[model samples]
Target: MFSKILIANRGEIACRVIRTARKLGVRTVAVYSDADAHALHVEMADEAVHIGPSPVGESYLRGDKIIAAALATGAEAIHPGYGFLSENPDFVDQVVAAGLTFIGPSATSIRAMGLKDAAKRLMEKAGVPVVPGYHGEAQEIVLLASKAREIGYPVLIKARAGGGGKGMRKVEHPDDFSEALSGARREAKAAFGDDRVLVEKYVDKPRHIEVQVFGDNFGNAVHLYERDCSAQRRHQKVIEEAPAPGMTPELRKAMTDAAVKAAKAISYSGAGTIEFIVDASQGLKPDRFWFMEMNTRLQVEHPVTEMVTGTDLVEWQLRVASGEKLPKTQAEITLSGHAFEARIYAEDAAKGFLPATGTLYHLKFPDTVPEGATMRVETGVRAGDAISPYYDPMIAKLVVHAKDRPLALQALVAALRQTEVAGSTVNAAFLAALAADPDFSKGDVDTGLIGRHQQALTEIAPPNADIVAAAALAASGAGALPPSNDPWSSLAGYQHFHPAARRTRLHYGEHDITAKVSVRPDGRFAVTLDEPYGSTNAHDLRAAPRLARWPGHVTVFSGAVGYTFAVPDPLARADESAASSGSLRAPMPGLVKLVRVTPGETVTKGQPLLILEAMKMEHTIAAPHDGVIAEIATEGAQVTDGTVLVRFAEDVHA
Candidate 1:
């Protein structure tokens, strides 16, 4: 094995690579930008190198800087961990030119599968089952639309380049085709610099099952079963599981064999995934699976595969890169128990899953069930790290494995509920709810599952009276005894004849709950709702509420959800009328990518008015009912959160 390897990525994947390298007794080097100067990965590595500024173009995407840093630090190889430059063929070529090993597939293999259209053509020629779609070179709008029509209605327009659901649109009718095409093309161009798209028939109730395949330089390849990543939101996989729930012996064999064939077709080496879209409308049949795309790098959901197969994928990558033969032959590998992985992201599930940025005040996960494979918390951030907008907002990947699918799923739900995060918005509660969902629990899952049940998944209900009382008690320091030697200071709410109730108010997202506390003789306290926001009575405190209090904010994890309350100052009052100026503010900090309307331009309700690009996604700002744009922000301007992007001529309510 190589003595030293440089990880050419950031966040969890980089930290993940470092852990494996350390296990192999290999010294690892980490490269960071300005945003990740004090990142967890940097602290974990044997040596750290500062490449450039925070912007990816200046730092992570600069192949030259990365190569130079690797050479300067005497790293014998570079591990491009999944994102930034993982699939960039040019970067792989440059690393090889520098006389260092690239711990992944060859540049030729990457180029072969770089474009979706070209890859589909190659898969077809290789005798691999491929979805019937337009994989031609035509880029004309008219030609593409004609191809969509020929493919039939409800077609999917996808960017030929890039992944992560960007530059992809699903049109259910012919009338919406043109607008969907234009939007997909625009996003594709912005994301990948390639507006070329391929039209494909949209499969109904498709289950995303991807086989984990590995190859060595000796032309040996093997499969590690499969992972069902059907639970998704916005085309992104939210929950993934190994040994697909409804998979049969014949179907698994067929799919795994096809995956190995696909990998061998490109002479693939190292760790790669061959993703297949399975038509589950009827059931899992051998003929129902078709090639979707091949990710030419280690996948984010590889842990579940590792847990089920008892194989270390990163170790395989390193061994193959070191010119070692395949670890095990196809016949030698065996599948064991089922496993599941849930991606924990710092995003708000209610507000359209918008990526959130904040400092993590606390982070915790639950332990696995007894005699089960330990629940793993794969993350890159610590308690005090800042989640910046310069990169992906993923907080961690929670993986659980058990004897059966039901047990594994039960563990997943428990782990999600026990996982706690504060100082930022998260989808933890949503994840728990999804795991416990009747449809999901029965394994009737697909890419459209989240969308079909979006309201239930994203709906944020106010905290109950008990939860509010808990927050109030924690915030007021009523439950815990005072940290003082003097008895008088500790005598809070204690009266000579009777204990007096102390009132404290807390606000949770516009709803106010006032908690009244009565201290007991033994320092224990009873808190009741002085003003209940929800239609429920607040009972007396059973025990001290579990809480984490930061300045101005208190996060209390009650039941399945964690509720955050703002400890408002009793002396300060706000002017509601002054805060209601008619303006459309940027929901988050981002660059104004487009201004679709000019000042005084009349726009109907729900009309696209402008676009903001942030966290690698485009958010459209639409007109609020019938209104005329009185003021417009310039395109390409960098705006902070709540910066007015557009102002209306008259009051919106008026």
Candidate 2:
């Protein structure tokens, strides 16, 4: 094995690679941008180097800088952890040219599957099923529209160089095809610097099932079963699992076979994933699955495959890259149990799951593997670490393994509830609710499930009144009072020296909860409050001194009623006009990549006018109405959330 290697990435993936490298006694080097100088990945590596500024183009995407760092650190190999430069064929070639081993597929294989168009052609040649689409390299808009027409309505406009959902759109009718294509092309240009696109038939109720394939230079390859990545928001996968729900033995065998064939055809080496969009309308058949795109590196959801196959893929990557033969064959691999992985992101699910940034004040996960919960939290962040916008907002990955899917789902929900993450707008409660969802538990999930149940998923999860009262009483700086207290110190009503009941108001979103807390003669709290369900008694507090430190909690006391209420922070909000408008605005902090329209340009509703690169993905600022551009406030400039980019002028008509 190589003595030392450079990880050409940052964040959790970089740390993940470092851990594996350490186990092999390989010294590791980490490259970071200016913004990540103190990042966890940097601190974890044996040595660290500063590449460039925070912008990925100047740092992570700079192949020469990364290569120099590797060479300077005397790294014998380089591992391009997914995203950034992982699938960039040119970068792989440069790394190999630098006289160091690239710990992944050869530059040739990456190129074969680098572009969606070429990859589809290659898959077809290998006899692997591919989506029926027009991937021809034709740039004429009219011709592309004709191809969409040929493919049928409800066609998808996707960037030939697409991943993470950027530069993709689903058009339901011919009339919407032109606008969608234009938007997708512009986004593709801004994101990948390639305006070329492809038209594909949209499969309804599509479930994303991808097979993990590994190979060695000796032309040997094996499939590590499959993972279902259908649960997504905005086309970005949020949850993933292995041994797909409802996947029969026959279907698994067929999918695995197709994946192996694709790998063998490419003479693929190292780790790669062959993703398929399985059509559920006609049931999962060998013929019903179509190739989506190939991820030419270790996937973010690789943990699920690891749990089921009982193998560490990173170890295999290192072994193969070091001129070793395949460690195992297709027949040797086996699946043991079901697994689920939810990508817990530092995002506001209530605000359309928009990326959020904050310090992770207190992060704790259950230590014990519960009755039904087998928890594995892989993270590089700590309590004091900040979720910066210069990178992906992923806080941690919570994976669970159980004997069956039901057990896994049940365990996952309970585990999420037990997770306590403070100081950020994490989607823990939302993820917990999703696990408890009846449809999700029964395996009725899709790409649109979150969107459909968005309201319920984002309803701010607040502690019960009793819990709030307990916290409040503790925060009141009052340890359990003595049974008998002096009249001056006692907060109870007396005959002559009577103390009126104290009321503390706490805000929970829009409503204020007032807790009438008073000390009883027996040294316990009594709390009374009116909830939506009418007047109720809530006094769930244990007599403990530690409870007295809850600063913002509201302790309530009524006749034999006592409870603790948590105070919600009103400062945590996206500052913007509450009223809806037809103008386009920036949804987060990002650099404007492009502005497609000029003043007086006519735009239909949902037309993309500009693109923003933030949190490691491209987001388009869309037009909300069919009108001419009134003004443009931003063009290739940095902006924050709610910063208006463009407004539409009233439409002119005959």
For residues 248-279, write the lDDT of model 2, one tens digit per residue: 88888888899999998889999999999988
lDDT of each: 0.86, 0.79
Task: Give lDDT for model 2.
Answer: 0.79
After TM-score superposition, the amount by which residue 180's alpha carbon in candidate 1 deviates from its true location, in angstroms, is: 1.4
Give the clash count for model 2.
22
- Each candidate's TM vs. the true structure? 0.95, 0.85
RMSD of each: 2.5, 5.8
Which regions in candidate 1 have their CA more than 4 angstroms from the true location? 368-373, 482-502, 520-522, 533-539, 542-544, 570-578, 651-654
The pairs that clash in candidate 1 are none
Superposed by TM-score, candidate 1 places the C-alpha of residue 208 at a distance from the truth, in angstroms, of 0.7
Off by over 4 Å in 2: 460-464, 467-505, 512-518, 526-587, 592-613, 616-632, 641-654
Predicted candidate 2, C-alpha RMSD: 5.8
Model 1 TM-score on a 0 to 1 scale: 0.95
